[model samples]
Target: MNDAVRELYSENRYPDLSHPVTDISRLWVSARAGGLERLPEPAACRVLELGCAGGQNLLPLAARYPKSEFTGLDYSDTAIRKARQASYEAGLHNIRFEAADLEHWRPSHPCDFLIAHGVFSWVPDEVKTRVLDLCGQVLSDNGVACISYNTLPGWSLRSGLVPLVKALANNPAAAGLGDSVESVAASLADMAGGGTAHAANVQAICRDMVKKGPTVLPFDDFAPVCDAVYFAQFASWAGERGLRYLGEARLQDNLPDGISPHAFDRLAPLATDPILLQQTLDLLSGRTHRNSLFCRVDAMLEDGMTTGVVMNFAAGRGLVELPPVESRVVGLFRQLLEEIAPSCLAMQELVERTADRLGAGWEPSRHGRELTGWIYQAARLGGIELRSEPLEIRSHSMAAPRLSALNLHFAAAGRPVVDARHFPCRFPDGHERLLAAMNGSRAADELAEHARAEFPELDFHRWLAHLAERGIVE
Candidate 1:
């Protein structure tokens, strides 16, 4: 283990701070499940998140799938503390967080869904093997595990610079690796003369780092502790552990159609082996980030269906149903949906019917327009149903539209609103009211007080849980 890197992570330092959301996962899962295949029902699914930092990704999932239980584990005490604090502040009972070394920690039970983001490439080889072994041992027979990592080719260029940067830092005495990296970066920037080739190269690298900004992993803490693996090695390792590669979490990364005709033609022969083909494609494309799904050989792929179908059925739509929809003058909605899937005859008919009902020139309500677009794509691909009713009038709201209304509706209904909207029962009603009240103005405590009045039946803790799930008033 690189003590420097371990120290860096120990201090809760990693350049990238972003977390995963099901909205993004839904798209990937939908694409992998054959573009529109209905997902398996979400109820009572057990999920485990490895290296779940501060519960940023897992907590929202717990809130959304109240029927599903979630557990998150991380090695960092600081991160565990933050995650626990966030969960406590939110008042969530379905989610649990624990700090444990991945090598020895054992799950009390098998998980139906497993996720390990930003950990595969950082842990030591022994720890990585333990993680893969745990996934195989603890994942339910029908479970799906998402593992993200840094790949080769693209990292070839970036990784080449790591040694140079570390050498330039030269100060072993620096208390923090971040301080060393910044010092080196600054020195390189200063040495780059007015217009020399060497200076230009330095400037270019600096410029790329700046553009990547938050996306780049900082050296101070993370650089010393991380280990990146090639796609081929990773796939082979997991395959040995009884996990078969499903597909990339980012669906677009797997589409040969997106590659140049010549590249696609050259890579086409490898398609017989999905893992090899994807690995080669990723290498060819110089992919830096990937979310790969895996399952046991006997595990059936999740067909994206769920009870939320009732919401669509109640709305008089079918698996192929499309609601009336129109683009804004800017065609933003149209463009977004177009990227989703090709329009089908059923969708066109629905649009025509809606146009007839509202005048031909009528523009769809922003919420209606976005929802229709998502539903149209989902239907075309047979993905999960886009349930839930409208909350915000427009897409560009301060709070998530789904969170605002769906959460409140669930609280009012006195039960989970499984099909309330695009997301599962992630939000509660009091949070929706609080979101409306905040509009980026109200203080957290003030919002909590207002929620107490509106949902007297819900205690302060419940309201806080709703608030934490949405990351509102926090």
Candidate 2:
């Protein structure tokens, strides 16, 4: 073990980050979308995370799913010390943490879900191989693994500059990163005479790195080793170890509809192989990183979505349309679905009702394919979700908007609130200021009256609907 590495982490703990894509529900759903029906339920499963600094990502899951088991492993003793304390203080009984070196730590039993977020690209080649090998060995028969990394062609430009960034980072004379980053950006500002995509790529990456600032720079740009590889190369490594790519943890990445069909169509014929197609897509799309999901090579994964396998998707509950959701065709469905908060309707009923709501804009016979594509894409984008089962929440719904005991508990404790789907969500801050009035007894207007002191400008009724839509309220 490198003492310097441990010391670096002891002083500079990486940010406490949580990703919806890393959540079991999202991973299970992504697997379901890929036609794997037999994976463990998100509500009751065993999850293990490698490189889990402070256990921020796994902590919330353990709290949200009491029956499930979670274990986080990290090499940093300080981080593990903090994670265990946090877990204990939160009264969480199902989660555990180990200060383990990934090179030597071994799981006593297989985990249903394995996560190695941001570990592959930063480690040495041998450690990277061991990560894939460990997944192939310790992953349960029905497990899914999410291994995220910096990808090549896209990340090539940024990674090539790492050495330079590190060299500049060594200068103690510079008091802050702003001036140092500016010097780097200024140096590259004239690349390709400042007008080409290559030049723009360099400048954009430099700015993004700077925006992350000092908190991220020490471990990232100035780390001893930060590497990136081609998507195909990474997949090949996993494949050699008996793990095969299933899909992406971020569902939207698996869908090609984000880009114009014409553009995608133009590139499809050039790359006949799917993996090559993905590489070409990344190159063209300027994607610098990927969160690829993998499963055992022999797993029963298919090409299309199937029934009997659960898929629970949901749309946001904002009163007005939200960005990352600009398709006019899906707007009506988003509006109609937002009202169905605290619950999810079956796809058929949902489609029929939403169609009726559309009236003249949608016709069944002409728009079947279009409608399917729209909602499915919307679901992928989280504008709407498709699920095989109704959400199991302890709170009552609709007539009297009440916060769930869990949500109320989280809010009262000054912890971040998680949506019904178990994603750590960004709710309007000072929500605790309004939670005391949401006990199912207060009328909407009365609640609005109380909210006026803190949120006079917010559309109270719509905000309530938004709360329900996000599954924050009962």
Q: Count the backbone clashes (under 3 Å) in each candidate.
A: 23, 5
Please name the candidate that would achieve the greatest lDDT relative to the true structure.
Answer: 2
lDDT of 2 by residue, 1-474 (tens): 355455676678786556766878667778777767578876789999999987768887887789999999988888898778777766889999999888888779999899998788777776787788899999888888999898777777777776666565556754343246545544554443447766777777776766766666666655555778898898898999898888788667865333666876687685447688888778667687889988888887766653223224433332223464565445666666667654666556656677777778786755545656665555565555544344544333366677755455555655556676656654577766576457678777777887787777877777777676667776
Model 1: ten consecutive residues of lowest lDDT: 387-396
Kindly list the per-residue Cα lDDT of model 1 for residues 252-291, writing each as its tens digit. 3455223585887787788687667877777656566677
**Per-model C-alpha lDDT, please?**
0.55, 0.71
What would the TM-scores of all predictions be?
A: 0.62, 0.75
The superposed Cα distance between candidate 2 and the true structure at residue 351, in angstroms, equals 4.2
Alpha-carbon runs more than 4 Å astray in model 2: 1-4, 166-194, 255-259, 269-272, 306-334, 341-373, 380-474
